[model samples]
Target: MLFTQAVRQFLEHLQAVDRSKETVKGYKAELGYFNHYLSVKHNGPVYLEDIQLEDMEAYMQHLKERKKSTATRNRVVYVLRSFYGYAVKRELCKKNHAELLEPVAIIQKERDFITEEELEILISHIHQPVIRTVIQTMFYTGGRITEMKNLKIKDVDLENEVIHIIEGKGKKNRDIPIGKTLHPILTNYFENIRDHENIETDYFFAIPKSGSISANYVNRLLKEAVDELGWNKHITAHVLRHSFGTNLLDKGASLVSIQKLLGHANLTVTSRYLHQDKDKLAEAVNLL
Candidate 1:
């Protein structure tokens, strides 16, 4: 069988299975790029079983030369592995060369967060009620952008001062307690603007009275605040969540506590939020 024919069958399998629409689209695009590379590297009539191991290795190097990130490379490699595995099962290929490919190491980027000083400046300068409240909620609750957008008016417990993330990442529901400093901001946004506007939608940060606030819009708002403060950092809603975790760490909160509050699946993911502080390191050495 031709290599393209095998790839087409694999894609059809993805669409016929449990893969989401977005996942299917992304895999299609990735495989399409791979097919293009194969076409350029060799003349026509490329057979599924004819691809040598050297060709597989060369394609891996080609990805690196294009400066693809570790995650992108890993995803591409995974797709190919699945494809070639299918080909092997169907007797179209002798073996799956993509299976033996080693994954690239993913280096976590430097944690970008808002300093306390920058936080104060950002809050003071944000005059719009909804926009300001959105930032405040993110900073205080450490809710994912999607979680925040999905928040309903009923999710905020004004009496208890808590926000409920009904279905965050992993489809896990969690609660984040409100800090005293952020209480008034959320209270007023809930009781005043959201109520006063009589927003036709029930979402906490719903815009246009039709749908929830989008992640892109939230980031754009954050960018405007960063630009106004002349801060060089490219801060976003996710950065605010990082700031929440880092700030909690500074306040002597445990990694386990942060993991639960941030709805992170494990301690390792939560640990990345704990940035190294010179003063904290000094204090630690002194204790030793």
Candidate 2:
């Protein structure tokens, strides 16, 4: 089949499999690039059987020349692999050219996290109750922004002082301890802001004035707070998660516990947050 036809079939399969909108968009972009390359290099639409390893290599070079990040290149390559694998499964292609393709190595860079003092400063400056509660939730639970946004009132166990994360990364569920430090604030925020009549809706952070708060609004509020404080670090909701893990590690929390709390499928993913506290590392090394 023609390359464009194959791409259309692949996107249909992705939709059937319930892929996220963002994933669908990435697949579309990557496949579009592949189709464009085939058209430009071969002067017409190349059939699936005409794909070669050299074409894959040239595409990698094209991505590099365009200054795409290693992660972006890796994702595009992955999308290509998935598309070709599907094509082969359906007998549309004789072989998958992307099967042996290797993604570009992504360098591990240390992530930036806010210190306890900096977090305190940011919280002090945030006067809005809803926003403050959202920030506090991230600080205490180490939950992802999506998790926080999707939180349901039923997930919170006030009597037990824990928040149950029903849907997290990799579809794993876990309960996170809610500290007493944030309990009263959360309780008050819920009482003041939550609509008791609409208790059936699962969203925990919904505004009564609107349907639900978008993740973009959360990021905008965070950016506004960051800009007002004139902090040099690039702050995001994930940074709060990083800060939580760093603070716990600084206080001698174990890697295994951190992994479970963060709902990470792998211990290695949780380890990235462990070494973010340079001052604590220096102090420990000096003491040793």
Candidate 3:
């Protein structure tokens, strides 16, 4: 089978298994670059069996030459591995060339987070009710943007004060408690802002006549608010999420509780938000 054809099959399988649209779109884009590279190198449609490990290695070099970040290059390579694994399973290819492609080491950086004061200021500047509610939800729930986008109106339980995160990352479902601050905001959005009756979609943040809003749409809304405040901080949805975890820690929420709330697979990932105030850390130590 042609490389492109195999990719099509793999993407179709992803959709058949109920993968999110964004996930399918991401795989298509990353695999498109590899297909383009193979087409240029071989000067025609490349077959799945004809792909060699060296060709994939060369593509890694190509990405490096273009100054792709370590994380991006690693993600592309990971996608290629997923693609070839599917191809091998389908018997379209005899060998999975991508299996040998090594991932680049990533240097972890300190995550950026918005302080409660900064977040308050940022929220004050967002004029759109939908955008404001979305931003608040991220901070309140510690949900990934994809999880937030996938949220349906039925997922929220106003009476019970919990938001059911269905099929989050790694196909995990968890519930986030609706806090006092966030509870009222969500109530206002549902009652006054969200036109669910006319929108014709179950998604909580659905665009009128459309489906769930794009991640880029949420990013652009955050960027506009940041720019208006003349803040130099690079705030994104993930930043708001980090802010949520960090703020919860500041307020004495335990790591285990946070792990469950954020739907983290492990406590180690949730522990990255351990940057407590210096004075507080010292006080804890002095208590001994």
Candidate 4:
């Protein structure tokens, strides 16, 4: 089978299995770049069997020479591994060249997060009620941006004050409690905006007469608000989630609880939010 043909079949399989649109789009982009590289190098189409382990390693070197970040390079490796894994399973290829591909070492960088005060300032600058509500929902729930974007109205139980996050990262579903502060915000949004806006879609957040709001739209709103405030902080919808987890930890929330709330697959993933300041570190030692 042709390399491109195998990629198409693998991507189609992702969609057929109910993978998120973002997942499918990401896979398509990564594989498309790989296909372009193969075609350019061979001066024509390449077959699945023609690919070797060296070809995969050479692509990683190419990404390095192109100055791609370690994280980006790792993502490409993951995509290739998934794509070729599918190919081998379907008998399209004899060897899984991507299986042996190694990701570059990634330096763990501290993620940026806002304090509750900063979050308030950021939200205050966003004047649109719809956008304000969306930002609040993101922070309060600590959900991934895509999960928030794809949230369905049916999953939100306002009366019970529980937001059911169905199929979050790793295909895991979890529930987040509606806090006292966010309860009123959500209630007002539902009654004043979502309910009366004539938004005829299953999505919780939507533009009137249009469908669900795009993730980029939310990020753009965040960027504009940060610019208006003249804050040097690089904020995004995901940062609100990071802030949520960080603030919870500052308030003495346990890692296990935060993991469940954030729908993290493990405590290790959730533990990254444990940012300790100098004062906190000093106090910890003094406690002994």
* lDDT of candidate 4 over 170-212, digit per residue (tens): 6778889999989998888888877554666888887774667
Q: Model 3: per-residue lDDT, tens digit, 28-98? A: 99999889999999999998888899999999999999999999999998899999888889888889889
For residue 117, what is the lDDT in candidate 2?
84
For TM-score, the strongest prediction is 4
Supply the global lDDT for candidate 1: 0.81
CA lDDT, every model vs. true structure: 0.81, 0.82, 0.88, 0.86
Ranking by lDDT: 3, 4, 2, 1
- Tell me the tens digit of each residue's lDDT in model 1 across 1-288: 887788788878877765655567787898888778888888665777788778877888898998988888889888888888888887778888988888888887777777667787897877666777888888887888878888988888878988888867656789999889889878777667775455677788866545568888778877887788888898888899999889888888889999999999889888876676778889999996
C-alpha TM-scores of all predictions: 0.76, 0.83, 0.89, 0.92
Which portions of model 4 miss their true places by more than 4 Å? 16-18, 195-197
Error of 2 at 17 (Å): 5.7
lDDT of 4 at 108: 85
For candidate 3, the 10 contiguous residues with the lowest summed lDDT are 206-215
Clashes of each: 0, 0, 0, 0
